[model samples]
Target: MGAFSLEGYKPFMAMVTMHSILAVMNLLAKAAFQQGFSSLVFVVYRQSIATLALLPALFFLRGRSGVAGMSVSLRGFCLIFLAALFGGTGNKILHFLGLNLGNASLVSALSNLVPSTTFVMAASVGLENVQLRSLITWAKISGTLVCVGGIMILTFYKGPRILNSSNPYLNLGTALDSVHYRWVLAVGCLLVSTSCWSLLLILQVPICKYVDPLPQALWLCLLSSLQTAPIVFFLEPNLSAWKINTVTELWACLFAGIFGSAVCFYLQSWCISVRGPVYCAMFMPLYTLITVVLAAITLHEELHIGSLIGAVAIIGGLYIVLWGKAEDSKRERNHIVDASEITISIDDKEDNITGQPLLVNSTR
Candidate 1:
């Protein structure tokens, strides 16, 4: 493989790891909810446990020298805190709540919308430049629309075929019945969670610019855990119950904090740095697929044709967007090369006019 191919391998591997962690986290969240934990309580436990685990690791890795030299401006600290709040506390809370109230498979399918949201937001903020004339760009937009259409079909259109299904895997009655007013509230929470997650992806670029990925992740986990402490204390102060939970529940919380929060956060940052945010975001549907499979195995959740179609649409859209992005990157590289050649040519002409050595500083 070429250098570029090897360079690409790292982020792809990181993304694979990230998706597996997220899928496992979803399974654990489902298990926690099954144990009758509230979303607020679950998130608080996740953050606090992860924070405690990460602090020791951070200290061990950096020692005093690492702690002393590291500096974050007040504004930077605030930004990181806010990102943690929205991304960690807010996102996880809603996700847990949604899973408690809805089918995990359905929720995971809907969560596949993250890449489309990110693409739209990035384009709006001028972080991603869209070329409307390009077929690749159109493919991306069309694919996104198709994905959204599939979601709408699944959500709103229950025809005779859907209503009369006898297959155990086609059961949506419970999930559909849950869509009452209270369920709307759950959906709203899930929307907020999804939005916060997308925002975290955007904010992470700038944060990584200033701080090391691991420490930044550690601090975010710490601060989010601290932020949740008061809420968990006042709202669900039943520490005794948590203390006496089954070994499985304890393991779930530990895995969420360590593998899901600390390890995944660091890996995501590393992946984004290596692959750029677009590529990282594009692979999210892989996580969704993992979530579906795990939900089916662990939760015994039924799978429907709509779910399969929705997954395909989401993945297809992601590929289209990534194709456009790759084209944009290629164009950018070509533009840079052209500009460099122009500068060199102009310098050569000036040297010829001056009748002097070119002083090109050729190291070769």
Candidate 2:
């Protein structure tokens, strides 16, 4: 039992650490935006550093089993580029901008939408099966709907202040007043980013079949840098925007690039390889909990009734989806086991029949 428990404990700890890292990254990103850094410039710098960080891995770990097995083609390259565009450039830029415009808690809460969106997108592409008759399928579908409903409520509804805290940066009243005006836009940005992330995950399902995860992630960072370069240059033409003028800005970029982007990819890839993607996904909501605590302490963020209510609904919906997935996986494994058992029984019966015939011949 101790050994059995340890297997679950180690992975849980890894997930906890990952979420902590992400929460810190969100805080740092928000701080950088508050320091007057342009979103595009930040994204450019983050992707550039992430690309560099992944460069060493590509060379040293070149001959790994998965990498050696896959053969990249022109089409595979295009898919990688598309993945970078949707997942890397689009997702990162929108997420940063959203974080810039919104509080960390809001951004974190919206992150739950990734799986829901992934489900919808996968089904759209005919990759996922949706059987209305199956309770598991209904759970997933209903869960997605509930999650979306929660998002709408959170985005549109802001009732009276449920919980207020003193913010060192600004008075609570002033901060809430400012956020009220930009609330819708910030939510829109978050939604778009979440959509891009979903598409990225969906795209990777196909891409992973043909490309290795390490090289895939490295190319994603590289291609994102390339894709974002012109956009950053056009939007932030001044050389001053490119310059890192403060220690805070430099630290934020390094954290986002090295840990948040590069290291995170490897950690998640490894976890998926070990425990599977569903296990990794089940830990996502932990990010929101960590972010909320960090934001309250560091940024003096407030909590609203709507935020709480929506968060609860979203979490409930997320659990439903996860439960459905777990059940589906169990069913699949059972199916394979049953089929193998039937095949073995048939083989055994055939062997007995042949042996009986040989015995009769020997007796004669």
Candidate 3:
């Protein structure tokens, strides 16, 4: 009935904050990779460190008794743990592997496809209501298509372009003359990683419905660490090599685990609870935009025209989806309000005819 209120504003602000933090986390991940850290080691260390950082907050906020008393059914715990496995471990592993093989700029650009994946999943799962007749919905679909098209451009259309000379960041393992087959494999990994991450959004909705956000996040991190530990220890088995190299790298890892993994996850869950999963999912491209801009500034990464166009399309599409959702919610609320007003009016008319008060008087 009313325009955007403080209640609406709060979730929007939270989403923006989450996007910014996630972008910084991406930069940190890139920086760590540039410093010669292996993708597997980076993910394991980052998650483990994040779990430790969360311990203090979990203790202080939840208290010793609350922590001890907190429990879920074994089945519920399993579901949550599996979600973390797919999202945190599986997604990160594929993403890192892809980044190792592909250009960070290209990987970052392609990551914008996450929202489209999420939207499709949400709609299929009945979490999002899609009105195909609406222009907003059409715009959203078009935008998503444009984003995909941009990715195709980046992947297929390669031409010599001016590189950013001022940027100290190297392209890492990415070489334009690299084997074409490797690029194909990397692109496949990126696609799989994006799909897994999108499914993470869908999985999270159910997990949050069953448990509190903070505990859900803590368990996810805990399970991710547990799942990764054996692989890192037994299969990889290079503890000494995993040690931090520089103070900056250590800080970057810590920040990724603490703020990026722990706090951001919690905030995202909270936002989804207040705003709905569809609304939160729509803001994902905003995070990509933040990543691109920060990569440009901090990593001195060159921007391609295709990336810019893709971003605009992604953002525009997300806006359409969000607008459609918001309008749908508005209409539903208005319908309720109108129904309430009619009921009240009918009661008032009855009271006037019967010569009795329509509303009950308070005793206190």
Candidate 4:
């Protein structure tokens, strides 16, 4: 029972680990981009590396897959293709571009929007089983609002800097001294990028049910590589950008491929499969908190008091959401129990009535 209870948290742990890998990817990509590495080329290389890394998983998945027509048919291919476009290729491109425009901290903080946006999208389509009057629904809403609130505090209000220092990634963010107007476009890009990923999260629920998560991730990586390679080659103005010049660039690409793309993709699909998309996405706000901590440690940046407050809010909000989801699940189980008891009672009553009619006829 203890092990079983612990196993229940596997999805939670996977999501947390996924966000941690993402935080590292964000840091490495920023360092490379600041050193003049091509973000477009990085996307292509990242996807290619990820595809190659996933090849060995094919051996493990043999005979274990039971995908039906919805998974094997052309429609399944289309769904995976669209997922790759929205998440693998398109999401990475926009995310890196957003990093170029804003600091990683800021970009990551703003990305707390993903959970709320995904929630809305899922609810709109009845994927989340939302009702306006439901208390459980309100809990989800309140939690999202609080999480967004925390992220907003972190973004706009930079209180006094604590543990202030300098590091390799210190200068990665764009300075607003001459580029104030770019904020709008920067935010717009991040918003759209996040929306794309959010939609992909929702899409994966059905896709994962029909297809295995590992193969789905492999297809996402492979197709994304194919889709990205040609455009990058043609559009890239610098041939020199293709080669890895520094150790930073080399490790960044490798880690982003192996851990960021491969591991994260699999974990995400698995989490959504087990927990539902909104539950899976509710962990997104933690990305901002984890990124802040990582930035402080690696970049030697100051951890402001506001950041601590924001972190608290993010954690609190996630607790609320999980509580609501748990309550909802318990209620569902109780309803099933109640329904079965009612059925048994009706069966007993019918038996009693039939037995009485036989006794009366015999006595007569």
Candidate 5:
């Protein structure tokens, strides 16, 4: 490789920061759930808050730089609305439902499905190439399978705890344990959420290609908030549940709205603009790892042998997928170079055949 590019570094940093924020948000959201708020209410409040925060920024940026221009069709608007439906509201609702019902670690572990599902969706829609003859394609495909396998292992096998500790984070777990939920239902809900999230990522490329990411993110949040408002009002019948009772609930709403929704949505849309959905989806395992560590440290959640094994598999799979993606990029770059070289060679031959002296070699 030649000199490292700062352009490459930014996306990595963004993804890491996004995942870290999400981990903290998850913990806080879990706390808020334990604080007697329904998951639907939390999702509604989170998106509403994020929409309120991002709307002003969108208008400000729109006036100064015209950054929020979408230039999309009615169909495009429809597509965007669908994206918000799945990625924004549906994804949030399902994830929170699963998280509230199941272990946070389990929710994170299941997130490994996003990249795989996104890969399939992309290939199906012709957003991603699938070259059966290419080793890189096989690598990418196998990586996805491996990730799924890891998820299956985690789901089926709890194994022995690798490290069981009494920690400060266990307070949330203690409070949360009061509400019991079926493990299978939680897993099913999470898997569906993962699929919806995959669709959202896949759909965003077309939606954001001409549009600015910030504005697209704003629309997503706004549409999501609007869509979920009625559902929240109907489901959360207790008027008192709408009020922020504790400092923890306030922090949870604030952090989730600011970091998880606004910042994360913008970054995610931007990354998809820079590098398509598959590349962005590859970061899900990283998010999973961060959540696992945070849950362990704070919730005093046990690090099970199965989870350890699954995490290793997921990490290895992510590496393979990333390597394959890099290889594909390199191959494309080389193909372009080869085409340029061949064009130059033919032009030179034509010059010689025409008895025209080539003044200079114009190839770079």
Candidate 6:
């Protein structure tokens, strides 16, 4: 029962659920874009709805956790703004644009980059330690390299069609076939969006650990909405494009906001607090897999040989990275235990000589 319990695996379950939500969001976003919806407008509505959804709960839970009364320092506020800029608004903008240019499958297939990028970013920021001499270090580096290669394969190569076109009438073939300039644009946008997501994950670690996760999510969404509305207004200028004409468009907005933004941000913040960015990102391949299957079924998008091979490489490399982390962590725990034993031995020696016990601080 203990082995089968959810108690010890809550973080794992949370991440799986989080990515599943995101998978649905990608499909909705893709459908919305296909219907001539503007990416910027979609972002604005998504953020606005997310912010509004968080408002009532914010008031109700105000003093319970002292979250409402807590003051944000300049540094904390800056972090929130940066996170909004990159993770919330900008990430969505770029991703939606990429989705417009590409397909839902592309959006998820390339998502494997998040864990690789986050692992490196986390190590650089001192959240994760890197020991040069450790063999695990090489595994991390190699896995990162393999992950990048997998993404390259996904973007550049579509060897053969694996999943036949569900509808013979629909003519979306080898998703990347017609790409002349659009392919470059799509790949660039997707890669940059992945980087922004990685940075957002890193920034949230500290905020979620010290501050209230709920308010940070609120501020993040609110700031994102505030920041995006003006730019979208300036560039688009025409209010007509902002209109949600169809029911699908309206549904996309609500679903993306309530589930994708609000719930995802809260879940992501909690996951980051408990698991760190790399661990949180390790489930990204599942997102891609879900989107790939869903896209094929619903969108009638062709599933190709490249996607399968690339996905395998990406998932394999991800597990390699996880294995390296596990080994490194085991070594670290053993080292800590050995050091404590050594400290006790030295304390015993001093006590024998001085006839008095010596106090030792084992704080590392």
| Winner by lDDT | 2
Stretches of candidate 4 off by over 4 Å are 1-9, 60-71, 142-156, 163-176, 179-185, 302-324, 343-364
**Residue pairs of candidate 2 with colliding backbone atoms:** none
| lDDT of model number 2 | 0.81
Clashes of each: 0, 0, 0, 0, 1, 0
- The C-alpha lDDT values of all candidates are 0.72, 0.81, 0.72, 0.75, 0.78, 0.80
- What lDDT, from 0 to 1, does candidate 4 have? 0.75
lDDT of 2 by residue, 167-208 (tens): 433222223454565766778999999999989887777787
Q: How far is candidate 4 from the true structure (C-alpha RMSD, Å)?
A: 4.4
What are the per-residue Cα lDDT tens digits for candidate 3 across 178-210? 455566577789888988888887787667656
Worst 10 residues of 2 by lDDT: 166-175
Instruction: Please tell me which predicted candidate would have the highest TM-score against the true structure.
Output: 2
**Ranked candidates (lDDT, high to low):** 2, 6, 5, 4, 3, 1
Per-residue CA lDDT of model 4 for 295-327, tens digit only, reads: 777766555666567656766776677677678
TM-score of each: 0.82, 0.87, 0.80, 0.80, 0.84, 0.86
User: Residue-wise lDDT of candidate 5 within 70-113, one digit each (tens)?
Assistant: 45678788988999999988999999988877767777777777
Runs with alpha carbons beyond 4 Å of true place in candidate 3: 1-10, 130-141, 159-163, 166-176, 179-184, 233-235, 331-364
- Candidate 2: where are CA atoms >4 Å away? 1-10, 61-71, 160-179, 343-364
RMSD of each: 6.3, 4.1, 6.2, 4.4, 6.4, 6.8
> Which consecutive 10 residues in model 6 have the weakest lDDT in total?
167-176
What lDDT score is found at residue 140 in candidate 4?
A: 84
Which prediction has more favorable TM-score, 1 or 3?
1
Q: Which digits, one per residue and each the tens of the lDDT, describe model 6 over residues 81-167?
A: 898999987788899888877777778877887877888998998877788887898898899899888887776776777786543
Distance from true location, Cα of 276 in model 1, Å = 1.4
